[model samples]
Target: MRLAMGFALITLFCSNSYADGYKLHPGTPTFQGKHFDIDIQEHCQEGEVTCPDVSYDSINKKTGARLHLKGRVMFNPNNYNFQGYIFDNGDYSYVLNPNHSKGTESVQIWNLNVFYKDKVIAFDEGIMQ
Candidate 1:
């Protein structure tokens, strides 16, 4: 029983330690489509765990209107799922599936969901080094 428990603990530890945790850089990356032009910034802090801070400045390119949002994303290490919020409230949120972001030593490919009032307004994807 003790051996099994020890193995389980080690497995959990290794998963957390080895998994590629989120990192945000100083450069803001933007994603533009036919309707939206969105700039995203990840405010990654040293020793940050679970929730990483993020913000967005998005423009409806057609109308020249804008939306600026600030919040954090809660990441599930087990499945690579993420839940994000706008305005620091649960009332506004979006979910990002497995394909949103992928990280390696050299770069991170981010396909983030931009949310406003429980709706996904835009998708911002780019490479950050």
Candidate 2:
């Protein structure tokens, strides 16, 4: 009985250690698509027209499990402007912008997470749709 109790205690302690070792960073967005995994960090202005910084990481040609890094996105209500950056984890990051600006449209926004097959493929500053 003592041996069994000892084993159980050891197992519980080890499992607890794993849980505490890598707590996912809060505000760390995650996206999972059909062929990619993207993680990003984003910052945005509340109830105002402003651009937030975004950092991204992704894996292409992914068959099973990958990672992506992306940057933040900015939105403008005055001119309906939108722009942002995405980190590809190699070389240069990509930039995105809305085609047109729609002024003072009562915009709503949020950080986004795209998931596919129970895995993260993308992380975006929540949508302002």
Candidate 3:
């Protein structure tokens, strides 16, 4: 009985560790523009995103206070495909995909944004107007 109990506890602990290994630091900043918050994620060349290099910030629109986190992504002129997420304090999240794909006729780019209030509002692909 003692051995069985010990084994069970060990198994439980090990499984939990492997369940979800990725952790985002809780240092997310807050923005005060109409009382809003924003989150941004950008993907560049591999092995480029690093701490004190790939972070976000909150800018006060009225006061023009640039409160931001320092972060940077690897740059490759040949490759233009990138993907990431942005969470806005207005209860919304955005998925940003800035890429240009060569095609037979024309190139294509995908951009999306989601807003949550009483319902979900989706912003689809389109030229910035």
* Candidate 1 off by > 4 Å: 1-29, 46-49, 77-91, 94-129
Worst 10 residues of 2 by lDDT: 95-104
Model 1 vs. true fold: TM: 0.42
lDDT on C-alpha atoms for all candidate structures: 0.53, 0.46, 0.42
Please provide, for model 2 over 11-74, each residue's C-alpha lDDT reduced to its tens digit, 9 standing for 90 to 100: 8887656644432344432543333334555555564445455656544322322444545555
TM-score of each: 0.42, 0.32, 0.28
Clashes in predicted model 1? 0
lDDT of 3 by residue, 13-116 (tens): 77655433322234542221132233444344555533123455433323334433434433344673334334444454433334345222343343445557
lDDT measured at residue 37 in model 1 versus the true structure, 0 to 100: 50
For all predictions, the C-alpha RMSD in Å is 19.5, 10.9, 17.5
lDDT of 1 by residue, 10-104 (tens): 98877655432311223443553344455656687754544457776655544556667776666667875554333444555533323344657
- The alpha-carbon deviation from the true structure for residue 96 of candidate 1, after best TM-score superposition, in angstroms, is 5.8
Which has the higher TM-score value, candidate number 1 or candidate number 2?
1
**Cα error, candidate 3, residue 126 (Å):** 3.2
Give me the runs in candidate 2 sitting further than 4 Å from their true place. 1-30, 59-70, 74-78, 83-85, 88-91, 95-129
Task: Write down the worst ten-residue block by lDDT for model 3.
Answer: 29-38
Clashing pairs in 1: none
